[model samples]
Target: MKRLLTAALLTLSIAAPNAFAGDTRLELPLQDLIDSPQAKEAGIDGSVRFYLSGQAHPAVVSRMGEDVSNKKTNGVGKSDVESCRWVALSVLKAFQESAKARGANAVVDITSYFKKNEFKSPTNYECYAGNIMSGVALKGTYAKVK
Candidate 1:
């Protein structure tokens, strides 16, 4: 009976998960880097292009940022990376919307800041203790890469 009750409790725990996260939409200045005219000329009207830090680009139009944190209470035995990936995706979506609105062809110099990313921060242990993962802060420069 004890084992059955324990199993039922575990099942209940796995059924419900909770987390606290946030989203930020930013308006960056990428006018000179890839203006509408320039973007149109370069055929860079969409968000398909991306350039990381080391990649070369014509110019920097603006800077954009988005931060997201995710947690899974039921994910005690699950993969943290997987849980964090969802948060990353949320950040990416935010980035995409802002970039598209600003007519940016790509996001450059993208960086990731995760919760529990390093031992120096309390989030690392807090995430483990609370069965929560947080902070997928992604910031980047918006530019035309064509």
Candidate 2:
């Protein structure tokens, strides 16, 4: 009887936390800052979408000049590389936060993009900036299986 009681208690302890595992949704950018205790208990998985925008000072263009000879002088190319990193990082953070909210342990199928035909010329000078928009979507079930 004691052994049976002990086994029942252990089972309850293990199963209690997983009882609440379910589909979750969230929107935030705090993944790196916090840890989700429920992730393991709830059996979580997730995915993220991201976007970024960037601008380059006139100095960038001036430095390159009209030197068609320079393969790297492409105005748009320079701005995208310079600013996309921060944008991607921010998007990643948002995805993490979403996963935590949804009780997801991790994210998959992550995708990113820059707004097409979304370039604008500086009104005053030759400065240019690129705009990027991103989104994160989570899909999966939460459960602790053996």
Candidate 3:
């Protein structure tokens, strides 16, 4: 009887996992994520600046190109906001690395590109937190700035 009950509960949970943990749509501050501890640990610095969509940035001496980072997010024991911040930081680090690889010093015109849907915001970026796996998708252009 105990085994049967456990099995049934498991099936129900698998069928409707969102009922237990709903997806959260968050528009968190772009600067806050960039200033997070994870970003600091990743060595993200002024060496490679990130300018959000619609934000005024230094003139691009050379436009390296644009790219996207759909970084993975593991909730673990942290809340949606916490997980989102970490994921966003990871995405930023990825972009910074790419900028370095491409001989660029800045990642500008950053946007939330979840599912390829561009969500432009000068101050905030979009993150989706889910029961299975949260994520932050960022699209940005790499450039050498003035």
Using lDDT as the measure, the top candidate is 3
Q: Which predicted model would earn the best TM-score? A: 3
Model 3 TM: 0.85
lDDT of each: 0.45, 0.29, 0.86
**Residues 100-134, candidate 2, lDDT per residue (tens digit)?**
56544433322122211122221110111223222
| Residue-level lDDT tens digits of model 1 in 1-146 | 99999999898787546433322222222323233354444444445454434545656555544323332333345455444433444554565666777776677665433342422221121123224443445446665454
lDDT over C-alpha atoms for residue 119 of model 3:
98
Off by over 4 Å in 2: 1-79, 113-146
Clashes of each: 5, 7, 0
Clashing pairs in 3: none
Cα lDDT of model 2 overall? Answer: 0.29
Task: Tell me how far the alpha carbon of residue 17 in candidate 2 is from the true structure, in angstroms, after superposition.
Answer: 53
Ranking by lDDT: 3, 1, 2
Point out where model 3 deviates above 4 Å.
Answer: 1-13, 16-22
Candidate 2: RMSD to truth: 22.4
